[model samples]
Target: MLQRPQANEFDSYFTKYVYNVGDKNINQFLRDQEQNIVHLYNTLSEKEAEHRYAPGKWSAKETLGHINDSERIMSYWLLSVARGDQTDLPGYDQETYVNHGDFNKSEVAALIADFQRARQSTLSLLDSISPAAWVRTGVVVHKRVTARTILYIIAGHTEHHMNIIKHYGNRLT
Candidate 1:
């Protein structure tokens, strides 16, 4: 098990919550997680994906959709910050996003494909950045965060959600 990178390794551009993700490069981590995500998605049938562990919780489809949305938004942040933009990025309302996801009606296969596409785009964008770009600091949600830390946080956030899906929803049944 690889422990997260130390705090000081990245600039303090991110909020304490995200900065806590430590040293994993956001793009690299997402690339690595692709295999695990694919495997997990493939293991489930349409019915399995729709099954939620509890009422009001997200189903597997919704979770996948959320990951796709999250990656896309994070990618946008990465792109702007990587270009040396110092603008403050706004935070999103996750509950609002989830409520509108319509996961119950979406096909599981398409949802995962959307996630893969978004992640791939994010990776391509990150891979193109110059070394100096990684060190740039920007504000998000009133906290200073470096591009490097942002990347790691994005990856870790997805992993965190995936773990929840596995343990609570996917594994329960």
Candidate 2:
């Protein structure tokens, strides 16, 4: 029964992501999301996965790869803060990461598999966090955030991308 973080717990830029989360138990929500996302992605054929909604946008596979990368980074932030790490974590450039990922070259099933493994690792790390540590704060990209804030961001970020991926349905066919 982890509580939702307060408005002040995270940066204002993250409000959309945090607000995307509902009243559901964070851990359960994450677990359910993992399955739902996998099922959604599994429905797409490899050729379909390569379809971008428009020019200059990410393909479905690249979007999933971005989601996987973001979750891993946020999970690391969660772990670092929960463990009382005082170091200021650096932010990454999503474009650079995605360009280097070469997700377009991989099978859709393989991308989904990578997502599953990354999410499972995130869940395991979440389980290891102590009750008192949820309130632990750390700096990321120069903004102070709590461990719980990072958790909500992770969930919200996925939901944001999921919505985008769903919208691709209209054009993918």
Candidate 3:
């Protein structure tokens, strides 16, 4: 089982995501969360998916798109660090990515499919890491992070958005 990353393993900004994971088994938690999110999102109507909780906030579809994009980026970081890459990875603006994504224009089903595919890719990458590689460090957005911390971030990031999506669902009902 993969151990939880220490606070020093990641940037303080990501503490919420990491703590959101708590003591759950990382591998199983990722798998189960994917299934739960996919199943929940599958039930949304097009109109419901397009509803934004606030005027400036992301709609449900855009939120899922953001989740997919973040997982892919973090997975890449995980791979790079696990492979002993010493390069410093840059940060991305989620708002800019979401604006360009045009997720609101796509079918909600399509966004959900994208989420599943991205998650599967992340899982596959995680499966291939050697035990020693989990502790490998890399610079991301100027902060030093371990390969395992990236994994937790991916999971925590999803969890954070899942909570928002759930709130959206509540308001829709």
Candidate 4:
């Protein structure tokens, strides 16, 4: 069984995300989340996809795009770190990425398709690593992190966005 990574295994901020993930079987959790989130996105109309809960909040589509972007970045970090890369990974600006993503202009189908591909890529990388590789540590945005913690973070990050889509952004209806 894959254990929940220890607090010391990742940056403190990321731990909140890891805690949000329910399943300790990180690999399966990642696979499950991809389908679950796409299911939720499929329920939204284009207008609902564009809906923003409050002023300055991201639209539902943008939020999904952000989730996709985050997964890609985190998974890249995990792969690099697990492969024993000691280089300090750069921190990304979420706002900058989202602002430029143009997800609002794209069809929901496109967004979901892109996200699915990114997720599949991540899963492929994860599957290539051995159990020992899950414990490999490296620097990302100045924080010491392990592959195990990144998996939990990915699962939890998806949960976070799902919650917002389900509640905050027009109830995902």
Candidate 5:
């Protein structure tokens, strides 16, 4: 029963992600969202999986990879910050991550499978934390953030990309 994070607990830019969470239970959201992602991925054809809605856009596989990458990093941050680490974290370049993933030639199911596994690890990590640690804060890319905030971001970021996947995946011909 994690309460929503306060506006003052995180930087303004992250508000959209947190706001996207609304009043839902964060842990339950994470668990259900995992199933949603898997279902979406399971519905895509191999050709659809490699689709890019327009020029210069990422393929569905790449987008899925990006979500996986983000979850892994943010979950690590959640772990690091919750444990009272004060280390300043650097921001990741999404484009670089997408380019490096080479997901275009990989199986989308494999990517989605990886994401599910990583997400389970994240869920376990969050569940294992002390209740007080959820409020722990740390500096991330020069912005002060809490473990609770990152959890919201983790869920919201997936939602954001899943919207993209649905939009682009629909455009597949």
Candidate 6:
């Protein structure tokens, strides 16, 4: 079995999921994420997507929505960090967000498409930045954070959820 990544493995699950992405390659982790989203989407059947791994846990659909919401927020955080914003970033209430999210009513294909589009948009924004910007820092959830750290967290965060989908009461549809 693939060893689980540390609980705090990727520093911030927000960036570790997508760090070490090749600067020379445009694919740069974001594409990988889009692909993973698609892969997971395709893996689940219509009924399976609605399956909840456990009582009170998010269903596959809700998990996809979580990924979408997180990427959107993290993209903004990335931009702020790149711009050297020092203000503490706001904390998100995942449970609240999921509760308010209507993923249960959304189609699987749409969720995948939305995630891909959002990720692509974020990557486009990131690709336009100067190298110096990558070193800039910002505050996230009241903690000092850097642009690079945010990127890694993105990848690691996805990986974290992927693990859950794979083992924590979920399986390939």
Which is better, 2 or 6, measured by lDDT? 2
Candidate 5 residue runs with Cα over 4 Å from true position: none
Give me the displacement of residue 38 in model 4, in angstroms: 1.3
Q: Who wins the lDDT comparison? A: 2
Q: lDDT score, residue 52, model 4? A: 85
TM-scores, one per candidate: 0.84, 0.98, 0.97, 0.94, 0.96, 0.81
RMSD of each: 3.7, 0.8, 1.0, 1.5, 1.0, 5.5
Q: In order, what lDDT does every prediction score?
A: 0.75, 0.92, 0.91, 0.86, 0.89, 0.72
True lDDT of residue 95, candidate 3: 96
lDDT of 2 at 172: 79
- In candidate 1, what are the lDDT values of residues 1-173, reduced to their tens digit? 23343466444543453543446654455677887898888888898888888988888888888888888887788788778888888879887898898886998778878888887787788668888787777776766666766677778778877888878753546
Which parts of model 1 are misplaced by more than 4 Å? 1-28, 169-172
Segments of candidate 6 deviating more than 4 angstroms: 1-27, 168-173
> What is candidate 2's TM-score against the reference?
0.98
Ranking by TM-score: 2, 3, 5, 4, 1, 6
Q: What would the per-residue lDDT of candidate 3 be over residues 1-173, giving only the tens digit for each residue?
A: 99999988988988998998999999999999999998998888998888888889998989999999999898889999999998999889999999999998999888888889999999999879999999999998898999999999999999999998886686653
**Candidate 1 or 5, higher lDDT?**
5
Model 2 C-alpha lDDT versus the unseen true structure: 0.92
Error of 2 at 102 (Å): 0.5
lDDT of 4 by residue, 1-173 (tens): 78988888988989779898765577777788888888988988998899888789899899989988998998888888899999999989999999999989989989999999999998888779899998999998898989888878888988888887788755433
**Candidate 6 Cα lDDT to native:** 0.72
Against the true structure, candidate 1 reaches a TM-score of 0.84
lDDT of 5 by residue, 71-114 (tens): 99998888988999999987899999999888878787798889
